[model samples]
Target: MSDAQELAALLAQLPDAELAGVVGAATEGRAGLAALHAVARSLADTLGHAPDVIDVTPDTLPVAGYSQSETVGGSGQVGAGPVAPGIPVPPAGIPTAPSIGGYSSAGVPTFESVRDKVEQRYGTSQGMGELDRQTPVGRSVEEQWEARAEAARERLDQIRKSMQGNDSE
Candidate 1:
């Protein structure tokens, strides 16, 4: 037999759980490294040459010379840091916080809606793939997805209500 057919036969012999586990482990291992490699490649392409070194350490970056004493909860109070001489500070009355009330509740609905749709669609389906149809493994996977989606929806609702309450006060 050809190498491809031999490998396919071996894969076909593996139990569904074992096959799924192997695929999941391989994907998880590659994802993080793949992201870092892609970012490095993009940066190299942008710079027109591969950099000899990439420094991610915060202290190595250029910024106004503010002493450690001026940092939050340092000698200075929070949001009261004193910039070094000649470093520009914002004019009065302008907001210093990145957002009006910090992070927003906008992203929760998008993810929860997608999860809800997935759960609704897959909840009644036999399985996602031909091999999984009518199998116990398929039922278990569907149930897990449904449970996670429901929990996330509930959590998002609670957060939305809480944020609304805060806004009204």
Candidate 2:
């Protein structure tokens, strides 16, 4: 089961008094977790990198027929229909940004290209580029395990020393 599920299960086993304490502690923990998540998300946005490689060939120009790249894996289907010479119209309310086709049709990036640029602009950071989940979440199980192991070792050493002291007493 997930950590969240396990946590919930443990919480369910608590009595009323203990449950209240747990709930209070959980509330505080959630607040801190939310703050950390926000920071991590913001950092990922700022530091995340997107590969920029749009085909700017004249044959692929929106005017000639090819559409700009939209989705992440899409190379952009060169529309068989005719294209106009004017600045391509994006959805209403979107900026009149310059067009990005083979011919550089003014003011219309494929949704993916636009996403890339936007990702570039405001940005997500992936914690020094270590295992950035595609969903822009935080560290992985390995990292969490490493951190927990270190803390556990420290606590175990302390307990061992305390037991030794009691034995001597």
Candidate 3:
């Protein structure tokens, strides 16, 4: 047996606290072994291997360049569609889909009127995607409204100052 195995055997025969140091060393050794394995894997991958590719199932064989695994059938038929997971199929007669002729000539919200609540709630935003906006109107409406609001605030401030001066007189 190896020295590690012999030491481990001897340690196993000891009482709990008497073997603690050896157990702790063994645990630290496992961490070092893991780090060594990671370094070796990184070096192997740098030399043109893929660690993710190594984690493939037998029935699912590699097709285009050996990274992706496509399911294989008995009669030589390959997987024909996308492999996207977590996509829930809509129930019968639901008709959950994007609409054709979805837009009107005026660009007003129309068709199914299936308002995306997240888009509508956020409206115009710096962090959101273009499609995540409530409507095409969101940008222009917010801009015009803000400009008008600033002008109105300035007029209100001027009126307030004038009223205060008149009261002082």
CA-lDDT, candidates in order:
0.55, 0.50, 0.52
Alpha-carbon shift of residue 56 in model 2 (angstroms): 60
lDDT of 2 by residue, 1-169 (tens): 7645765776688555454433333334356566654554444344542113212123423434543432223334455334433433433322332442422444334677767777776554544455454333544655787899999999999999999999999
Q: How accurate is candidate 3 locally (lDDT)?
A: 0.52
Instruction: Please state every model's RMSD to the true fold in angstroms.
Output: 23.7, 26.1, 21.7
Winner by TM-score between candidate 3 and candidate 1: 1
| Cα RMSD for predicted model 1 | 23.7
Model 1: which ten-residue window has the lowest total lDDT? 98-107
Q: Could you give candidate 3's per-residue lDDT for residues 29-114 as a string of tens digits?
A: 35656665555455555555433322112343335664334644455556654543323343343232344245443434563554
Off by over 4 Å in 3: 1-136
TM-score of 2: 0.19
Number of colliding residue pairs in each model: 0, 18, 0
